[model samples]
Target: MKINFDKYHGCGNDFIIINNLSNTFPKDSENQIKKICNRRFGIGADGLILINYNDKFPFEMIYYNSDGKISTMCGNGGRCVMHYCYSNDIIDNKSEFLACDGIHHGIINDDYVKVSMSDVNGYEKYNDYLFLNTGSPHLVKFVDDVSSLDLINISRNIQKSNRFDNGVNVNLVSRKNDNLYEIRTYERGVEDETLSCGTGAVASALALNILSLINSKTVNLDTKGGLLTVDFNKSNSKYTDIHLSGKVKKVFTGILEL
Candidate 1:
């Protein structure tokens, strides 16, 4: 099979986006999906996204991890797929779509894309870390220096703990100011530190808000890949209208043979 794919990235969290409107792409071949996502031997990406037709929404977003498992909602993947939809005239600048988590709305302004994320209703706090789900589960920890920590080992140990089930995306956050933070994330499905993680950023920002570390409703995050901005509204211990925004761009387009 020869598949036409376009690569896109938001703050360096890359994905291979395919227009599967005709349902031509093979959805059951996990090994083939994994091979295509291989860094050394295939078209490298953190995940793959399929833009499929939907009855209620403009389209449907089906996402897979680098391991080729149909995974939970990916914030960066959502933004990149929105970009693809807009560029392909499938949708306008602002649109709503269905993802793995739920319905999400996105607005595109030039190179910037802002997607609404799922509302978080619960939190788990440990002495040194915090846990929350922002579309995907994340473990947030504060570190003096994010650049110096060994993410793989730390995340692996935490993933093994009874506190976490299966695995969790681990985020190391450093406070730059009341409204600014620096984050480095080890994503579970990717199984390593990614340059940036949209959901992880959202988890970290909301965690900081709950800790009263952030004074502003809009939080600015600096990740190793680039910058992301998260804005939200809090009322009576509930968070809503949460939006994640960042710059997304098309990296390239190619044909992959299987």
Candidate 2:
């Protein structure tokens, strides 16, 4: 089978995007996606994404990690999908889209996309970490020095720990300065420290708000790969109307063989 795919990146977290609205591919067949996203033996990417039309919204998206399992909600994936959706006329310049989590609205203006993610209604506290699910599960921790920690190794250990048996994406964050933070994330399915993670960034930013590290409607985040901005409204320590803003860039296009 020949699969048409487009390569896209939101802050250097690259993915192979496919428009599978026709349902030409079987619903459960994701093995090929994993093979294609393999770094060494296949077309390298952080994961694979499918943009398909749904009766509920302008479009629906399915996300898979490099492991090829249809995983949880993805932040950056949402932004990139909108970039293609609006650009391809699947939706107008601004529209509501549905992802794995729920209905999300976004505005796409050329290279910039402002995605409105779900509000966080709950939080789990730990001496060393804060746990939250923003569409996808995330474990946020603060380190003495962000530059000195190895995100991959630490995240792998935390993900496998009995504490979070289902596994969770891990974010190591540091307050770079007032109103700005630096974050490094280890994604679950990718099983490595991706250059950027939208949900992870959102989790970290919200955690900061809960911890009183920053108090503002919008937060600036500097990922290892690029820049991402987060906006939200808070009441009684709960955040709502969360939006992630960043440069969702297009890299190239290609056809994959299976």
Candidate 3:
């Protein structure tokens, strides 16, 4: 079978997006999914996204990590899929879709897509690090120098430390200024350092806010891949109106044979 897919990216995070509205893709075939994401043998990507038809919403987003596993919500993936929906007329400039996390709303602004993330009720603090789930579970720590840290080894160690049984996306962030921060993330499902991570970015920003490290409600994040912005409203320790925005582009369309 030949699977037609489109490639898209938000910042540097890329995905293989397929239109699964007709249910043509065999989602149960984990091996096939893994093959399709193989960098050398298939369409290389950080993850795969399926835009499925939904009765309650405009569409449903089903995301899978490149490892061929159904993972948690992805912020960058959400933005890219929303951009895909807009570009393909699956939605207008704005849309509402159901994802693994819950219902999410998104809007397209030229090349930039803004996605409204779910509210975060609380977080756990361990020494200088903070842990929270912003669509996906994340462990956030503010470092003195983000670029100088040994990201892979450190993140890998903590992920396997059994501190988080389900594992967590680890984010190393450094305050660049009052409203801006630099971040490097080791995503859980991908099990590697990605160019950028949407949920990780949100978790890092919220963690900074919770620690009173930032004076602005809107936080700017610079990753190895590109720049992303997160805006939110906090009330009674609950974060609402959460929006993650960044540049997204459709790279190409291709057919993968299996």
Write down the TM-score of every candidate.
0.97, 0.96, 0.97
Tens-digit lDDT string for candidate 1 (1-258): 888899999999999999988889975878988988999988999999999888899999998899988889999999999999999999999999999889999999988999999998868886578989998989898778888889889888777778666578999999787667999999987899999999999999998888788778899999988999999998877789999999999999999787
How well is each residue in 218-258 modelled by candidate 2, as lDDT tens digits?
A: 88999988999999998886789999999988888887776
Error of 2 at 233 (Å): 0.4
- lDDT-sorted candidate list, best first: 3, 1, 2
Model 3: per-residue lDDT, tens digit, 73-167? 99999999999889888999988899999999999999999999999999998656898999998889998999898999988888777678777
Model 2 ranges with Cα > 4 A deviation: none
Which ranges of candidate 1 are over 4 A from the true structure? none
Candidate with top TM-score is 3
Better of 2 and 3 by lDDT: 3
- Give each prediction's root-mean-square deviation over alpha carbons: 1.1, 1.2, 1.0
Backbone clash count for every predicted candidate, in the order shown: 0, 0, 0
Residue 67 displacement (Å), model 1: 0.8
For candidate 3, the per-residue lDDT at 46 reads: 94
For model 3 the TM-score comes to 0.97
